[model samples]
Target chain A: MILRLGADFLVAVLFSLWAGRPGWPGFVIGLAIGFVIVSTSDLAFGRPNHGRRLLWMIHFAGYFLAILIRANLQIAREILTPGFNQTPRIVRYPVQDLDDLQVTVLANCITLTPGTLVVDASEDGRWLYVHCMYAEDRAKAVNGLQKLDDRLRREVFSW
Target chain B: MDTVRDVITVILLGSGLSFMLIGAWGVVRLPDAYHRLHASSKCSTLGLFGMLAGAVVYIGTVDALIKAALTLLFTVVATPVGSHILAKAAHSRGLRQWDHTLSDELADDQRDGPPQV
Candidate 1:
């Protein structure tokens, strides 16, 4: 639980830097607000087993940052190259092994991926409708997405 | 020289801000969250990016240049994220569209295909 609090605090500090939030005062306030948010989640969900959750959160953040870097590189290449890849299609791909927040996280991860955008999801959350700029292998891509979803959504978030 | 840079910066900043302001208006005035997201996500980001770029041009330091590049990169990443989550939430909450949304392709798959598990 203390680890979770510290991890959440780190997240808050990173968020402040990312947001360009003014100064030390702003950073402190940001952490406070983040603390409230984390505490509430703990209260509501009764907190995940302490050590495992910390490990997961660290792993999750690292994985996310790495993926973000990769995605940006692809986008940059696509923009610069201008006519290399084609296979744009919007399709609804089925998903399993997740809940709402995980699904949400999955969908956003898709959106962040350069070649794809998550257009919508099914009413029952059975499928995520994705429009891929280069939709070569939906199965392969979705599998990659599932790996990410499992690591980030399942382990880190305690979802 | 300074005047020229200032004018260019002003134009760039104005263009970006206009995109953002207009997009924000679209968000408020547009009929639905989906379309509004279309406006806000697409336009506002480009706007913000443009504004940031303009500011970067004005500052023209190595640090500022790196920061601007990072900003552009991350905004591209984050905006779509936010939009996707909102769209998913809307879909889950039964927010129907104004028009027939072409066809429910995912729904079709469930009935026709074998069980996926």
Candidate 2:
């Protein structure tokens, strides 16, 4: 809850600064408004484990950028070349122990990465169906997803 | 230092535009909805990041820099969720893949009545 409030305060201050009023008074006002909204929302939806998530956010930002750059370059190369060698396939990724939020985060990470799109999650949220543009080596792709899931579970959920 | 910043800004802007163009090309050329989402989401997110970085360099104000950073963060977090939803919706609607699709584990799961996960 405290971390969420801090994040909200940061956003509010940034917004105020972006609005061309970068002063302490504006920032204080923004912080107050942010606190109210964040507190109420936290009340409605159970408070997030924000400290772990904040740490994960920092770690994931760097990791995400590295992957994003590589994926962008790969897709750009594929697009520029002729006769793309994509072997698209859908793979079922098991999500046995993680809760819904973890599964959702894992799924989003999969979609954000190039060459993979999370097509669906089972109603029970125990499985994520991911479509891979390069699926010639299915086991390798699933292994990659597994590694990402493990990292997220470790860093974000500490599970 | 100013000249260096200008050069960096140009490079970032050019790369960002190039990624966006590539994403547009992929949208047109990709064979299926899911494939298009794969291309569009990654490319656009990276493109926006690049462009925003360029803007931050060019503006060189604390406020502008903070805003750009926020935009990039939000984009990184939000784009995947947007793509995930679109892909899920397309799949649930029974959107067909390209004729050459190599595997369909989800379809198989439907037939087999959900595997023991």
Candidate 3:
């Protein structure tokens, strides 16, 4: 506990210097609370590979936004057009990054997109159960997500 | 000496407040959850860091400064993870997304590799 505080304080100092703001009281208070909260959670849950996990997570997050924004724009267009045919169907899209966390992320991205909903997700790392909305080209809709995986692999994971 | 510190402190406080406000705005204005996370996480951390810097300067101690700095770093490190988890959980829960998702990562996973993380 002593060590934890010490370590937290040390980290707080470093971060403050880097951020370059002034005022001691709020900084100290907030830092202490943050440290305690994070440590408690870390202790309760086994320490994950913070370095690699964080790396992957950050990249995942970055791409996730790009994909999400694009998806929203596409949907708006579909909605405004009277001829828009919202033919939603369940399809199997193959998934990788065998980590359960990664798979879950992918599944959710699919469901979130407009005109589509993930009907079922049970492929045993072989394929993902995906539903598409107005897929003019089945291959195209499935192909779009590949860039996210590539970005994640290149930026976050080596393989 | 005191005057210098006071000026620095005020500046820090002002900047910190701005960041917090910006983050709040982002939370509301951003198009979707993912965008909101980007603005809030990135901006909130920046704001927190700014506030901490002010604290360090006011205290005028290397120890205090170091502690403040650590807070910034840890927050930077931790926030993305939290955001990632939230995003993933949101996605799985079937939140609606933009339609123009180009270069589907999952499709690539199907052909040559795995899915998006």
CA lDDT, every model vs. true structure: 0.64, 0.81, 0.58
Between candidates 2 and 3, the DockQ winner: 2
- DockQ score, prediction 3: 0.05
Considering DockQ, which of the candidate structures 1 and 2 is the better prediction for this target? 2
Model 1: TM-score, first chain: 0.63
For residues A20-54, write the lDDT of model 3, one tens digit per residue: 75456556755766576656666677764333554
Q: What ranking of all candidate models by DockQ puts the best one first?
A: 2, 1, 3
- Using lDDT, rank the candidates from best to worst: 2, 1, 3
How many angstroms is residue A137 displaced in model 3 relative to the true structure, after the best TM-score fit? Answer: 20
Best by TM-score: 2
Evaluate residue B76 in candidate 1 and report its C-alpha lDDT on the 0 to 100 scale: 70
C-alpha TM-score for every candidate:
0.48, 0.80, 0.42
Tens-place lDDT per residue, model 3, B47-72, is: 78668988888888756866786787
In candidate 1, what are the lDDT values of residues A1-159, reduced to their tens digit? 556667676766676677786455556777777766776777688764444566676777677656654554454444345343445444677775568866766766666544556777665777777755555666665676567666665665563
Off by over 4 Å in 3: A1-159, B99-117
Ranking by TM-score: 2, 1, 3
Error of 2 at A78 (Å): 1.4
